[model samples]
Target: MNLETIQANARSSLGDALKSISVQGVAEHSGKAYGIVALMYHRLALCEMLADVRVDRFQVLLCKSALVRIHLMRLAASGKAAHPLTTCASQNFSFVDAITAGQLDLAVELARLTSDRHEPRSEYEDDFLLHRFMQKRLLHLHAGEDHDFQSLMDRWERIVEGEHAPYFDVCRALLQRDGEGFHDALLAVIEERGRLFRQKDVYPEDARRTDGALFMNGLALLRLAELNGMPTQREYPNIPHFARLPVSKLPLPLDSWMRPEEGLPV
Candidate 1:
């Protein structure tokens, strides 16, 4: 099958998984319900990531459903006293309805969780850092002045310390002005990213892990660099292992499921 078919199958599998999760007989604000919601959030976020790469709309809906469920979980966990499962009709779960009726803040947080798992936390991290670093592009394209990246960028700079320091530096420089050193800096970070990818031992093993996205992550970075005028012919060494892997086998990063944090949608 082609990329599209593989993606469809993956999305279907995810939908089936979501359907199989029984929220019945579980108490609100209990650890059991929280665990199930967290699992749903984790898998939904993963599907959202996949949808992003393939530009799939149905997968985006799946993500919205996951986000909505997360909002319901949050409400229940906070002692708001609402039936989580009954929030949506049993026969049909409308993702758009959920987003419209749910919390936007929660959706953003979910986006970040999936994004954070893209690669080594230090090197390729961002608030909504996955999918070729599309959050920045999205912010530039769609977000208003109310949306600021300063804090997220600061967090990223803090996390990615040392030899990989140039990662965000290049990002900032490119953000400021594409100067003579822009291409060099971009290539430098990409090279460092490639080096990190070579070290498979650096990744964590978890059910919701996204370590497998390194190949996609690298390709996204390379495309971004080239889009901004980085050299096209430059040798990208030893990274095809990621490209070679089947799209279905990639993993989502995690274990921080229930831990409260931030995110955004693709």
Candidate 2:
């Protein structure tokens, strides 16, 4: 199949997955419903990173993945009040807090229990292929100029006959241009993706565990960029600068600082 064909298949698979997840059921089982959301979020982040290379439009892929995640999470949250699968009213389940607290291991376990017993075979296969394609693209981006861009594209084509490695090695080579700038671009891309996630309401407000993970992971990547001196600003534009110039160099007393006329000619 060609790149378009593969993307179409992936999109169709995600659509089907959304259709299978009932909103009422999802709301009732919010705790368990979030596993898929977390996974899809991770996939979207990957797509955004790979999108910088651009053989095809990674934005489209990211959108499709995000759509599926939102639908599933909404469906789960909608079912919360009506479903009686588990009625422990006294117990509080905060999905967002759990994730932020680094409870993914538990989240996964719950997700397994809540996931559809009869998995859609085609969707499963499609998900696997999507992940594999993303991983391959990532490897290519990381490979840089050791292999010529054309040669890398050719190799990628051989690995997946129908697909292309978006921009080949262009982005990889550019990373060397100004590491900080590249890192900043990456952060900007991630922030853009995060906005999309919020707009779609893909995750339950109470279950923002995935959001925390994304932030933490992004931080780690920025740190790596810094360690390599890849370019701190490029790597972490979302992170504020600790060395920002203060409004004034003078260490004025708090009372003086607060008084509008204290340091100004009245």
Stretches > 4 Å off in candidate 1:
1-20, 24-137, 147-163, 177-186, 204-266
**lDDT (tens digit, per residue) of candidate 2 on 105-167:** 222222222332223432333223222222232233332213233443354445555543222
TM-score for candidate 1:
0.38
For candidate 1, the 10 contiguous residues with the lowest summed lDDT are 244-253
Any runs in candidate 2 off by more than 4 Å, and if so which?
1-177, 207-214, 234-266
What TM-scores do the predictions have? 0.38, 0.28
TM-score of 2: 0.28
In model 2, the worst 10-residue window by lDDT is: 87-96
Q: What CA RMSD would candidate 1 show?
A: 12.1
Which candidate number maximizes lDDT? 1
